[model samples]
Target: MTATGAGQAYGIEALNVWCGLARLTAADLFAGRGLDPERLDNLMMSERSIGLPIEDPVTNAVNAARPLIEALPPEERARIELVVTSTESGVDYSKSLTSYVHKYLGLNRHCRLIEVKQACFGATAAVQTAVGYLASGISPGAKALVIATDVAVVDEKAEYSEPAAGHGAAAMLLSDRPRVLAMDLGAFGNYSYETLDSARPSPRFDIADVDRSLFAYLDCLKNAYADYAARVTDVDFTRDFDHLVMHTPFAGLVKAGHRKMMREQGVTGPRIDEDFARRVAPSLIYPGAVGNLCSGSVYLALASLLDSGVVTAPSRVGLFSYGSGCSSEFFSGIVDEQSAATVAEQGIGKRLEARARITFDEYLAVLEHNLECLVPVENRTVDPAEWEPLLDRVGDRPEILTFTGVKDYHRQYAWR
Candidate 1:
């Protein structure tokens, strides 16, 4: 039987994040690389998720989602009729990452699996698509799994991008339950245009125009919010939304975006800071710790808010998602105490704290192989034992999905 009821409600029923097993403290990385100390404060980040050779998009997606899927009852699991994966770090041009993720997550065979690519905007697109699917009367009780997974490809040469880039996935279950976030359906704003702000020309590398990217991000936020204001009724940027979450490439950018919005509202002096401290600071906690989760940034921020213990009562959350080359949307959702309780149950903060903190040198050593995650290789293999020392540092060594190797131009994975 369909788990969804006739009473109309649909959005993210459950949500979880996996930012990998290790992190490099941003301050240490900056110091080791001889970067400016003031910039570290400007970045406003503590660590960046360190991608390992033993992990890839497949593993990350599986690990991020396994907990939710395994905890699902059989009938409910079967209701997971769709899986949409969003990524810019794709492993193959011909094959979608959803195949491996869906298989590894042990979802029902009868399911719709697809992938969406839009830089940081992909997650929102996938979430909206899933919500729409479930809201469609044809699939009255269906649930969709939306996963945004990626591997970091930056190094010291990437300058600031290196320290701000993160590797991982965020899994969201969309159904009529909407336990975590009850979306304000039909309330959304959009903006997009052709601009070479940033892109990955090859699986091996990425190119970006820092200035252009920054300007585009701010522009998108402003216009998108204006578009949203036009569409939604009685919208007050500072008053309507109890909290605000934006696609964060870095925590500092979010602060800047908030400032732009406040300035638009003629907000000045300490009230802007007061509003940010109250409505925006909670969402930055996770992004500051794990860097950017690419398309998952906004969702991670939402998770941060949920885990922030702020939703004592029902709260309205304004969400903004932007991707470069460049598309954006401003949307709204409702969160309650249940949202806080469910996200807290995931213990995201504790898990992040538990990651093995690697030094800059150690981070360098691992990047050589981790960077190969998206490369098209005919025959390659990875041994978990090769990285046991790092895992040893992990202490608990939870069994996460691991990338074994590639054989016959195909990727292989296992639990370890």
Candidate 2:
């Protein structure tokens, strides 16, 4: 189970991260929204969330990816063999988001483009797929670009759903040299089953049996961890991993899953609480502030932890990724020797700090604008020139990519 002799050639080279710039504090969202204030207060407690405009999903992918792509020496960028976009928030049905992203980024025309959809687990699949491709002997010096981006748009009017909804994106550059965590393909732990934990029959919003979804997530964690544990006996997970990063739809579920996982693994008592705080709490900071990014959530947690500069090479990080409807995996990777250099280059912290806090009213307005984009462009008699600027101003952050209104059935996006 150790990476030795496991042939871990395709490790992450670089990771770029970004989140929705518009902020919504949970307390402000429920202050006077025609609800039982006390109950809403108890539900969200004192948490804040962020949301992206409907168009921002693709924009997020591009904005997040541009940095890593630009940072690459031109020769490396030219040799990119594959570009894969993983998301639950795709702008077009007929054409993959990779098509737009590939063109916008001006990648080599010969590169292959693909899009993956499997709720939040899509990005993991993309990374694995890239690993498989490299294992198959791709062109020399070729690399793969895997981008996980998503926006959580729920029924803003529904109190239970709004608190868990948020948006963000992360882009990873996979190559032979490891700058970030070197993935161990051989030691993956996975669990999958058919269940109606969460689904979206229509494109507008997701409907979830929260209680069922939470149970499934924890159960999957237990099963996947057991599978992985059977192969690697040298380290007890609680005592080994420097950090445990879990997909966070909201913070409480992960905390609950942590306790359940410990009990299932036959570990107990005060040490469990202490281990959770030391190994798991650091990964939650960004997710706690940003809400859920669906496909981007798990990786975002890892990126946030590494961006802190506290974790270094040779440290093991346990990661659990869950995609509702529902697939989950428990995997682990070792931080690389060059992690400090990678973290120094990543702009995640700066982007997050630059984010603007907006009123609950502004959040609602952005929600309404996103809902409007859901309507088919063909159905509306709209002129792009008139509405483009208005939509571009949704999040109001300068220099980032934004999605403008559709023009003659083609979705429009640009850096503004």
Best by lDDT: 1
Tens-digit lDDT string for candidate 2 (184-300): 666677888888888755557777887898888988888888777776656576676778989887767788888887876787999788977878877777777777778788887
The alpha-carbon deviation from the true structure for residue 85 of candidate 1, after best TM-score superposition, in angstroms, is: 0.5
Clashing pairs in 1: none
Report the poorest 10 consecutive residues by lDDT, candidate 2: 379-388
Cα lDDT tens digits, model 1, 1-416, are 11122358789989999988999999888888888888888888988888788999999899999888987899999999889999999888878999999888888899988888999999899898888878887977889999999988876668878889988999998888999999888788899998999999888778889999999999999999888878777788878899999999998999999998899899999999999999999999999999989999999999999998887999889999999999999998889999999888788888898889898889989988877778998999899899988988874667888999999998998888
TM-scores of the models, in the order given: 0.97, 0.90
Choose the strongest candidate by TM-score: 1
TM-score of 2: 0.90
Clashing pairs in 2: none
